[model samples]
Target: MTAYNKEEIIHQLESHQLWIDTLGKEGNKLGFDEVDFCNIDIDLIKYPLDQAYLTACTFDGMNLYGKDMHSSLICSSTFITTNLENADFYKADVSYVDFTNANVKNARYAKSDCSEAIFIKADLTNAKLISCSLYLTDFREATLKNVDVSSSSFKGVLLKGAKLSGIKGLEDAFIKSINIGTPEIPILIEGEEAVQWIINNCSTDEQI
Candidate 1:
């Protein structure tokens, strides 16, 4: 990934002000439908980047603490090893994004579409994903302590090798479409039973 300095980020914002809104914009302002942030590590923690369209960007090892990205479109971005602690992605479209080994503790992804996103070995402790779309998302070997996925869509989701201790809202989550790799676990389960399965089996067994 390319290392982006502050000057480049400023230039991109200025050149693409019509398309890119560095901070949240007011009424009658136009921002880029999608910002090209490929292979750049830009620190966006200080700015509120809501309603941005940033596809195919690489944010590897960037620190994005407590940033607000509500209603943004960020498909196919790479956030590998990035620190996204307490970041708010409410109702964002983050399809096909890669968040492997990223620190997403206390992050909020409520009502977001995260289809086909990769979270392998990512630290997602206490994250909130209520009513989010997670179709075909991969969370293998990820830490999910106290994460909330209640009422979320989990069709074809990968939970193998995932550490799911104290995770909440699994009972209410739709898990009929999960890919656990083995048929030993029941194909269909209610909310309470699913939580029990995570606690009893996922904690003790090697799901890979």
Candidate 2:
């Protein structure tokens, strides 16, 4: 039982506000057990983590509020300027994670996979992400206010100047901006003939 020391996780993150006043109410909070701790990169701006696993870690300027991080894997992690508000990370795997300038507001990430992640300028305001897949991810200028993004599978992704205000399933969501703009003007609220049959047969090609 001698594994926790990055100065004991920055002295339990200065003794409060450390993952919601200690492990978000101590319902299985990990102060240190990142797969039995053999140094899995725990600096995070000199440490203050919660329910940590932090696989392949790098985390800069860390705070990590309300952390649970169930089923942690966190492959190829980075997460610069991290705070991770309301963190849960359920079904976590998080492949190729970068999450630059991270906040992850209201984070849950239920059924998380996050393949090829990058999330530059991340906030993810009101994030839930139920049944997540996020394939080929790299949410440039990410905000995603009131996010729900249901039954997701966004292949070859890159939402340039991303907004999509208050998303809900988004049908068969697969946007590289449908090939460099000028074709995304469908909001009729009654399926406008199934969104013009996906603008006359989908797959406009964002890039190979």
Candidate 3:
């Protein structure tokens, strides 16, 4: 496990305060739309980014293990290849965020609105997404082994080429046009029982 550098992170965030100050108007004109937050721990409860209106941020290779970010208002951020094991994102409005290739094992995303978010090739083993609003979310080629999506709304979600083995709570969730296998087969399941039926019948391909 990596260590969390609190002071250094605070310094860096403070250094980027000017960008936050000019985010909406001047920052956009100056092309300062992204923030690099690699390899740090973020305690959003103390220093929040809820109203930052930040876009296209990067969090590659960061250590965010077990960090609580309930009700945060981050959007369109990228977390590629980051360590997010056991992180809590309950009720966070994290729409359109990219979590590609990130380690999200055992992460809590209950009641969060992750609409249109990208999770391509992400490791979501054992993650809890209970009651999450996952409308139009993309999970292409991602690993979903042991993931719990109970009561989560996955309307219009994309699951093409994704590994859906061992996932829980598809018995009571909305679904439409979610691919379960290769595009050649074009598996489109509807409702909870159909999802379970596909899972039981389909043979998994290479896990992402």
In order, candidate lDDTs are 0.74, 0.59, 0.70
The Cα error of candidate 2 at residue 105, in Å, is 22
Judged by lDDT against the true structure, how good is candidate 1?
Answer: 0.74
Question: lDDT tens digits, residues 12-64, model 1?
Answer: 55444434443434222213333434344444554446666667676677778
lDDT of 3 by residue, 109-204 (tens): 899999988898998888999999988788887788788888888766777767777777877666554655543555566676557654774355
- Each prediction's total of clashing residue pairs, residues at least 3 apart in sequence or on different chains, is 4, 0, 0
Query: What is the alpha-carbon RMSD of candidate 2 to the true structure?
Result: 12.4
Give the top-scoring candidate (TM-score): 1
TM-score of each: 0.76, 0.29, 0.70
lDDT-based ranking, best first?
1, 3, 2
Preferred candidate (lDDT higher): 1 or 2: 1
RMSD of 1: 4.9
Model 1: weakest 10-residue lDDT segment is 26-35
